[model samples]
Target: MTDSYDRVAVVTGADSGIGKATAVLLAEHGFDVGITYHEDEEGAWETAALVREAGKAAAVRRHDLTDPVRAAHVVDELAGELGGIGVLVNNAGTGSSEPLLGMDYERWRSVLSVDLDGPFLCAQRAARRMATEGRGGRIVNVTSVHEEYPRVGAGPYCAAKGGLKLLSRVLALELAVYGITVNTVAPGEIATPMTGQEDRVPRAGSRPGYPIPRPGDAREVAAVIAFIASPAASYMTGSSVFVDGGMVTMGPQAAGALQSGDWR
Candidate 1:
């Protein structure tokens, strides 16, 4: 039997963290991968090496998704290099936590540029390429738990992520005609270099608020993404898959509920 991902996939911010994990996983699943990095060409190369190790073709490129023109060029180049793009993973993002009262317009806009606008532009370009190629595609936006719920001091991150959720839905609805599926994969606290390792334990210990009672791993999130980007997920689109281990369902009072409610 032939694999569903014999084509190609482009994963942005693939230098490290969940982006890196997803890129590696997809490559392992028989998809040639285009790995994009901002300033970390070495990291991108490392990811490419892993893709090559998976017996898949790999292309490493530099892209600053915050710049629309450059981002478009990056997509065109990746499609050219990879032969064609079968999947687009908008996983490039950064976040900062600060009180809304002290937030500057520049910082807020920066967050939106990376977390929201970047994905939309990349997805639009990739979707157009897929539509023009007359072959269906998958677009997965690596969003966050804050996409639906708000957290303290993370106003900008929350705003951008929330916007991305709707963007994914809108694209999903419109792209359905083109046989292209669009969806969001929202993850909770996962242990990644970006999440500050020294503080990871403390953050995870607070997971009494999480129904799973434990933090997740990058590989776990990667697996979820790989599935979403596969042919098996054909009927799934315009949806946000929460890989948060049931944290979103419990809300902030989850800890209180767990502490006071039945053990069974």
Candidate 2:
């Protein structure tokens, strides 16, 4: 496997949440970062500033996963500007709240487009570059605990994440010859804007249903991603690492204890 050795990393949806945290942490780990934001240009710049504070170079770009084909080009653009991509973190994603029966086809497609198609295309771009450069790299896809479990109102989300998990495994097998490692980081409920808990400390709240009983911090998830992107993780690939605070383990127990149909 290739040693990361102060290389470049590209993180999507980096305007906030796990993406932002991962970008900053990677910079601290001797990597220059390329950040992509969907709607928050200011937040992207803020993340860039944090990377700069880490004494590493940072580049910001607007990435719309809805237009995945064109959006994937941003990977090349960032790689060109930052030298080359040594790590590709496919963290940009969208989720759905409507049930399978109530949701329209458009909504389902939207979630799949951003959550699955976008990552596939972005990974393709980054992988091609890595293969050509002849240096091993890392491809970390930020999925959710739903990848292995199910949620009542998140059919599309679960489907997309589940598909991404399998896709990562396939990529891992195919890319092994290139010395590139591919893995998935599956998180549970996180205290981020996406979860309606932006800038809030997870310890301030409580989740009786969860094993850890509180939401996870973005940095906690980022820490794992940083490790997977590092040279230390060279031997690990096609693995799904759970940063879910044991949430996935409590499904049967939590379900058995529910008092009402309110869970539906």
Best by TM-score: 2
lDDT of 2 at 185: 98
Model 2, 1-264: lDDT tens digits are: 878433999999999999999999999999999999999999999999999999999999999999999999999999999999999999999888777988889888999999999999999999999999887899999999989998888998999999999999999999999999999999999999999897556873488777788999999999999999999999999999999878889877987998899878
Candidate 2 stretches with Cα past 4 Å from truth are: 4-6
TM-score of 2: 0.98
Q: Please give the distance, in angstroms, between residue 193's alpha carbon in candidate 2 and its true position after superposition.
A: 0.2
> Over all chains combined, what TM-score does candidate 1 have?
0.90
Candidate 2 clashes between residue pairs 3 or more apart in a chain or in different chains: none
Q: Where is the poorest 10-residue window by lDDT in model 1? A: 197-206
Per-residue lDDT over 1-264 for candidate 1, one digit per residue giving the tens place of the 0 to 100 score? 112332799999899888889999999988999999998888889999999999999998888866855675787798898899989999988897888899899888888888888888889899898888776889999999999998888898999999999989999889988889999999998878778643133344556666777787888899999998998888899999989888787754665565543532
Q: After superposition, how far is residue 187 of candidate 2 from its true place, in Å?
A: 0.4
* Candidate closest to the true structure, highest lDDT: 2
Q: Once superposed on the true structure, which residue ranges of model 1 sit more than 4 Å away at CA? A: 1-6, 198-206, 255-264
